[model samples]
Target: METAYIKTPVGIARIEGDEHGVSVISIVDEATQLSPEIPNILSKAAQELHEYFEGERRDFSFALNPRGTDFQKAVWQELRDIPFGKTTSYMELSRKLGDVKAIRAVAAANGKNPLWIVVPCHRVIGSDGSLTGYAGGLWRKKWLLEHETPPVQHRLF
Candidate 1:
């Protein structure tokens, strides 16, 4: 596995992965350099993330290989299906997975998602339309949500 840290508008982001794909992308307070040998996967992920933050890209084009259990993988897959400018609730996701009772589990899986924005985990919210738990701080989640929303039109006076 290879690792590299990047600075973004929200915070420092740590990226880790290998030839399989990106396994983790998390926010932190400081940047850390990877070993002198840079893996192709980590380099690609970093480039894609840079494009994403620059608003020059919408969907991620790089491959992902997040590590998790079957259920967690399923939940992460569902999160990836969420469109860039949309949001869903834990209840909605639970229902989509065909088990409304699994809200807690679904939420836990969402919380454990390692791909962050690339996986679109920030699109999920509380049932009452409130921003809920995010591995990255809720403020960062809020900013991400706001950033994805379409620009409002204004009329000239």
Candidate 2:
């Protein structure tokens, strides 16, 4: 798989994939070398990510090939359906999947999401609207959510 590391506002993002599609996009806190040359196959994905960070794009159009079990794949698919600036809860996701009791499983699948912002696992929150567990760290999650939020306009009157 082709790999590229790009620096972002929150941290260094590691993107991996090939012609088959992007398989992983993870954030890392450690200091690491950025890719000297972006692979030809991953250029689009890299550019799209830059647009996303710049608030010029709301949805991704590139192919995704995240590796996971059937259940995990299902959960990830649902995550993609979440609006760019909206948030959903674990319980709500479980209900959408037609299994309220499967909340834990759904949470697990969300936690295991490998595509990062592409899949939008960061959109998932606790039932109480609290920012919860994020493999990349809660701070990064908050940064992502805040970045996606539309600015509230104040009245000049």
Candidate 3:
């Protein structure tokens, strides 16, 4: 897999993939420099990510190939169906996956998602509307949710 980095509002993002498709797009938790020469596939990912962070694009339209088990792949694909700015409880996700009893497993798969903004694992929240576990850190998760959410208008009565 070819890897490249790009600076995002929250942090440096590392994108990886080849002709097959994008395998991973993640925040570099250990810090990395942007690629001086970006590959074709990575360039498309970086551009879409930049647009996503800029709030100019709500959904991504690039090819993806996240590596995971069959169950995990199912979970990730379901995550993709989640609309931008919307939040789903782990229980709801588990139900969607056709097994509410697998909520914990569903949460586990969600946590293991390799593609960051592309997979949108951050959209999962607690049943009571509270933010929950995010591998990229809660702050970044909050930022992404806020970024996707439209501004709340105030009424001047």
Candidate 4:
């Protein structure tokens, strides 16, 4: 798999993929070297990610090939269905998966999502509407959510 690193507002993002598709996009906190040149296979993903961070794009159009179990894949697919700036609770996601009791399992799969922002696991929240847990970091999650949020409009009465 070809790998590349790019600087994002949150931190350095590591992108991995090949001809098949992009398999991973994750954040790294430790100091790491950025790619001198992005590979042809990963250039679109890198550019799309930059567009996402810049608020120029709402949805990703590149191919994704995240490696995971069937259940995890199902959960990740549902995550993509969530609107660009909307949030959903773990319970609600479990309900959508047709198994309310699988809340824990859904949460586990969400936590294991490898595509990061591409899969949008950060959009999942606690039932109480709290920014619960994120593999990247809660601060980063908050930043992502805030970044996606549409600006408030004022009415001049």
Candidate 4, residue 129: how far the Cα is off, in Å? 0.9
Cα lDDT of model 3 by residue, 5-114, tens digit: 88999988888899888998888878577789889877878888889878798888888988899999999999999999998999999999899999999999999999
**Candidate 2, residue 30: CA error in Å?**
1.6
Per residue, candidate 2 scores C-alpha lDDT tens digits across 1-157 of: 9999997888889999988999999987789998988899888889999999999999999889999999999999999999999999999999999999999999999999999899999999998999999999998899999999968999999
Q: Report the lDDT tens digits of candidate 1 across residue range 60-112.
A: 87878889999999998899889888999999999999999999999999989
Q: Is candidate 3 or candidate 4 better by lDDT?
A: 4
**What C-alpha lDDT do the candidate models reach, one value each?**
0.86, 0.93, 0.90, 0.94
Error of 1 at 18 (Å): 0.9
> What lDDT score is found at residue 111 in candidate 1?
87
In terms of TM-score, which candidate is stronger, 1 or 4?
A: 4
Error of 4 at 49 (Å): 0.4
Candidate numbers, best lDDT first, in rank order: 4, 2, 3, 1
The TM-score, computed over Cα atoms with residue i paired to residue i, of candidate 2 is 0.97
Q: Tell me each candidate's TM-score.
A: 0.91, 0.97, 0.95, 0.97
How many residue pairs clash (N, CA or C atoms closer than 3 angstroms) in each of the candidate models, in the order given?
0, 0, 0, 0
TM-score: model 4 vs. ground truth: 0.97
Worst 10 residues of 3 by lDDT: 25-34
lDDT of 1 at 57: 75
